[model samples]
Target: MKKNKMSFETSFWTGLAEGNPFREVDAFFAFAYLDYYKQNLSEMVIYSRKTKVYKQDNPSDVFVLYTAFNFFLKVCYGLQKKSKKWKVKDSLCCETVFHLTSLTQEEYENPFIVFQKAFGENTLEEFELFLCQIVELSLSPHAGDPDAELTTPYIHLIKMLDAGELIRERGVEKIRKTDQMDPVA
Candidate 1:
């Protein structure tokens, strides 16, 4: 999907500074799902980076990005559970996500600071979207596979996020210098 003029950090803080992180996520979803993105698959999305021709970014990319950050909410929820720093409350609208809250604002935007302190900034990004998909596929019909409404992928995802701590314990730039990750794909 196309990036917005507003950086994610800005949009994230606008809502989060008010104690409702979900509002930020929903704002992104709203901005990305605008009418322009609702065009036919063949329609031009934006100018290509290397050429004048318009870019036909798949509409599905928005969904992928949405799912990715949506999963982030859960990750924060799970992390907060153990750290007990944010004092979060459950989301009544959708149990899958928890709206993380914080009273103080540090110069740096590190809601996951507790984990970061213990594990380095490895969790600055998501664990692995590809690996998660493969594992879920191999296991087949996991918790929320139309059942575990079933299951909480967020908690499951947190389990993997914790692995970053283990990886950082060994001390490296990141997990395998492994980047280009995240999402339900």
Candidate 2:
């Protein structure tokens, strides 16, 4: 007999829908999307004398950004089909912090569990740190282009997390609090 421990997806999305993307187990994915959802990485970088949004600095940023994008796309796809199972395009999939990244399908119908196993490496701390690094980098004045699609939300989420203000919690409590309250009418 096996017992099921709550998964990062459940925990992360619970916090996200509630408004907190920086919760304990969900911080990594939260931070990952902190920048990813801001813009599409599939586009090539345009150089400008004014700012270096995609200046050739390190490859890791691209890696994490793509990973974040994949995560988002997977979720969106899952919801559209009413199934959490999703198939990631190979170009956007990544397995580790040291690889070129690859695409893959959710083997267990559980995206977060697969994500945890693929990148978690059984280290929540590492995931948290990775998230922090992405968040800090995203905050840089010269990080991604301010006009880029991903910049605004990414920055906004980072600001909220850095301030230690957890987003609204999504769960029975929220429903209970909302429904149990008297109507204004």
For each candidate in the order shown, give its overall lDDT on alpha carbons.
0.32, 0.33
TM-score: model 2 vs. ground truth: 0.26
Query: Could you give me the TM-score of model 1 versus the true structure?
Result: 0.23
Model 1 per-residue lDDT tens digits across residues 1-185: 99323223433422432233334334433444322322311121111111332222344444444354444443334444343333223223432222222111320123344444423433433333422432333233222233222023333333333332222222222113337668776
Badly placed stretches (over 4 Å) of model 1 are: 1-58, 61-85, 88-155, 158-185
Clashing pairs in 2: 18-168, 19-167, 20-167, 38-149, 38-150, 39-150, 93-102
Tens-digit lDDT string for candidate 2 (1-185): 89533322433333433222223324434464423433423222222112344425764565555444334433322222322332222323434532312213333122233433323232334433434444434434354444444333333223322221111121111112235678789
What is the clash tally of candidate 2?
A: 7
User: In candidate 1, where is summed lDDT lowest over 10 consecutive residues?
Assistant: 40-49
Local distance difference test, candidate 1:
0.32
> Which candidate achieves the best lDDT against the true structure?
2
